[model samples]
Target chain A: SQCPQKWKRIFCTRCNSKRHSRDRCPSVWRVYLLKDDRPKKRKKLILPMHSIYCYNCGLKGHFGDDCDLRRSSRVPNEDGSAFSGDNLTNSLKKEYFQ
Target chain B: SKDEDANILNMDFPWTINRDHSKQKEIADWLTLEIRDFVSYISPNRKEIELRNQTIGKLRDAVQHHWPDANLHVFGSYATDLYLPGSDIDCVVNSKAGDKQSRNCLYSLASHLKKEGLAEDIEIIAKARVPIIKFVEPLSKIHVDVSFERTNGLEAAKLIRGWLDSTNGLRELVLIVKQFLQARRLNKVHTGGLGGFSIICLVYSFLHLHPRILANEINPIENLGVLLIDFFELYGKNFGYDHVALSVMNGKATYLPKSNWKELHPIKSTFQLAIQDPGDATNNISRGSFNIRDIKKAFAGAFDLLTNRCFELHRAKLKDRQGCSILGNVIKYRGKARDFRDE
Candidate 1:
């Protein structure tokens, strides 16, 4: 890591990428945060936001709220539009028809 | 002077930012100057605060006259140094706690205030989540909200104020972010928007997370500028609304075991925003604010504008500068919200 030159204080202990520090390396944890004021083994971690993985549906690209699989899973209405009234039951029936 | 200035920025602030714009302290310096100007213009001066203090002292005197044991304690922004120009002074009357009793206390106090001829337009938000007595003190020309419900607001404000005192650029960062919210009318929690205290907490959460600022390696002004962009970037794109709690005590995004934070706080899952109250973990500060989809939209817009210099320049032309408000139009620009009515 080239942090000692740029950050003047931070140093790289790992692969020493020229771009970012060791903690910020893609190989390391997403983010290294302390659980409290004191240094402890149980460090606080936050997931990197740039990943293809979604926290929502545990799928790729989209989050849980905007899950297309969940959306498309719901049964179409009498008029062919959709609502989430009986999504699971309706989706099962739709899947049976398919 | 050159050596001292170099010492201040630690030798490489200029050269370090040559290729990577993320480390651009120059831009941060510009943004810092703008924020300082805004803060100076908007924040109540020492004299004004003193006057408010004297007026509050009189109000306290009035409370003691009626109920000797009970005290009218000042909490919220006025208690701390965060109160903006003409913003309401939030005070809680430390007395009995109950919905009906709180209502009665407000009723009695309103009547007393009327008799004393100190205030007017004494309306009680009787059915509110935290029922409060709202009145306009003519002498100070400031609105005052008095509540009987005890929140950890005072203690939280104290903790934040302590942080503001300790950190060099925290006040600038917070005030800038606050002004941005206020301009956009997103800072008021009562109208289903973020509150002043919530904004303070949010800024604190960010400052806590960003290691460079904590280490005092970056100048606060520069840090504020850079963080201002990163603030929108993180909140806009990165931070998962459901999965993490903005824990001030922990100073990190406390990841939860459950998908939604209902187990941690039942009321939190009800709203789109998931900012955890530092004072009380159970209460979601953004409860009244809109659902998740709409919030993401606003943040996304702000993020785009801040990132694109061309867009900012264009928007800056449309700003309404009452004084130092560089973001008047930009921040306040209300983008379309996704209707969650069907959902």
Candidate 2:
């Protein structure tokens, strides 16, 4: 028997259907198969070009490190166990490895 | 009897059933020994590790010639100390020297390596999420993938190593679980299976939470065996598809406030198993090239083999009972890919 892992539903942005994505919707796939044509969405080509966002929180208007909720400036817990065991501070301890 | 060799071969390799039902303890003991031996067999030996390191160093040297300031690292299994006997070397090159726009750096690096006779099939897959240069050493048959992805390689490696050192027997337990997953053919991510990082995270999440729930007086190693069984059981039977998020950070199920994780983070939420990366909370290690249903089914299959009546016959006298067969069924058997397409 095949192991069943649920597929992360790739949806059609416009129709919000699992059957097809905006690029290859049934409406498009059916036509493209017969006519040998590209999807309307691709043909139009209105893509988001220069959109930059926080790599960490994936938010707008700031960098990942500068983002407010990035745990950017983490301090040891008040209990004082050396490192929070989080070890975010020493993220680039490349020298130690070298 | 005169033509014994041919007769034996013709008789479909004669086998004897010395299964003494009364000697269940002895059978369990034998299984345990087999498992212990399997662990050693699957592990990256000193020579293997050294060879891998040397291979990585050769690649780094090649890359450095082109870009003197480039920092090439051996990441993934080699860095994390969880490689099997013949695991591929995963390398990441962090360089300020190349066209950072696309994987242009990788393509350029690939061309440079090609000049040095770095073996055949040197391909640059620049369109991948982490665009990589994949090549195989023709002589040693060692495969290496070099990525120019902006990854915190050192931090990621250190975090895992630190976690391994945190608890006794943790490293061994992780290795054993990895072996189990590999044997079952469910360890591959590209073929809609769980990768090594995600598997390690899953086991960590299990061991972390088990201590709180199951209060046993057994030593850590024995405790690991029990936890391993539960690892299959919990993910197989109890885990909810929409409800719980698998995480190793807090050592517990990090519950999503609402039912759907995809709805909450639609942009990046891709996998049925959202294993939260401890180092970077935003990064879901389980995402990319995985089918949720398949992973769940693999767990369910393992659980069934472990708990079902017939399979349990051989397991009854074993210390962890499901120990021997759990690893066997997952590692040895190959199952068809169940319904996993999004639609």
Candidate 3:
């Protein structure tokens, strides 16, 4: 017989959900800035940043330090700015710093 | 037996690190597979685990024989299932009577172990903060440490079990980190090295506080390779050791600045690797680990090695990539090796 699954009565302080834990909570984004159990509400409606592309690995989910793929020799777009380091960092700060 | 022999032979030929991958996702995918394979390769197999269980059983019987009320309880890495090969088994003798820690009790148990032939090389350390009997099981040659009347190790083991159960990819990352530290002889606690518990907190905090993980953007299992590098980079080069402390209290893992920790623990060292003990907030779990400089430098070196190897492999010709291992640059598995991807 299969062993019974371990029961854990956990409360997610981030989103105040019992169905999920804090780390897996959908409402928990950038937990480093969390000051208390009641996470501050974002001023702007935050969309999933998975679409943000990384020039290093040519992936859409991450960029900068988050991108561990080997650095590409050239950017995909030379003339048109697909994304800029300053813009990415600024947007990230604005979204996560609230 | 034939397959085992073939695997032993495979160890002689070094494993390959990477193949041609254009996207970061592809490399991440490759790394995830390698991490899985490496963990399985180094992990104790069924026979080895069974031997540990039998060893524990023998010690338990011996303890109960002497004191019918006393019982031996396995704790630490053995109990948590996070142990690497050759790691000593940690146990505590629980009894209603509080005299199990006396000098006489320690020597009596040591003598009993010697007479029974179940143990050898017995050493009774009575002057320790916690009196313990250290011995090696004659049959398995496995080292074991038995302490008297302690429940803290058991509690810590249970906490780790809860973590391993809830967190995805925690075991994989922990095993890799443990092996990495073990290779450099930096895993010993008495010598001011990062112990198993401290390493767990480090990886646990990194996983929980990672921007990508917290945002639910990347699956950790799919991105173990990248996460491994980022782990090194954060702890090695970026983490503010003097200002930042790690915590896993109330099932929430996060990095707390030292100033905030100072409010709770005013007298604690400000520039040390302070991981607040989960059981008691006032106590620092990583207080014994004093070699922060060496640990940080080693982690930074690993980050450099992994990134440099990844870059070199990315630019290498297909023929040059043969038998090159990126993870090998950091952790060398001194075990019978076999390629799992080929199977």
State each model's CA lDDT, in order. 0.52, 0.51, 0.69
Instruction: Pick the TM-score winner.
Output: 3
- Rank all candidate structures by their DockQ, best first, as comma-separated numbers: 1, 3, 2
RMSD in angstroms, all models? Answer: 15.8, 21.0, 14.5
DockQ of each: 0.03, 0.01, 0.03
In angstroms, the error of model 3 at B232 is: 0.2
Q: Write the per-residue lDDT of candidate 1 for residues B178-197, one digit (tens) a residue.
A: 76667666676656666776
Better of 1 and 3 by lDDT: 3
lDDT of 1 at B30: 41
Worst 10 residues of 1 chain A by lDDT: A79-88
Per-model TM against the reference: 0.62, 0.60, 0.75
Give the CA lDDT, 0 to 100, for residue B37 in model 1: 47
Give, for candidate 1 chain B, the lowest lDDT window spanning 10 residues.
B334-343
For A4-97, candidate 3 gives per-residue lDDT tens digits of 4336676777657576655544222111212122436433234345434332333345433444543322212221121222222344556633
Model 3 CAPRI rating: incorrect
lDDT of 3 by residue, B138-231 (tens): 9999999999999999999999999888887789999999989988888998999999999998888777656656544456776688778768
Task: List, residue by residue over B1-343, the lDDT tens digit for candidate 2.
Answer: 2334343344311211111122334332333333444455445556665777677777888878878878688888888878765677788877775444266666777778777877568887888666777888665668888777467666677777877776545666677667666766677888877787776776665554432221222234533333444466555544433434555454333333113445336533332666667766667677753676766666667645543432344435544453333344444312311111111
Q: Score chain A of model 2 by TM-score against the reference chain A.
A: 0.22
Give the better candidate number (2 or 3) by TM-score.
3
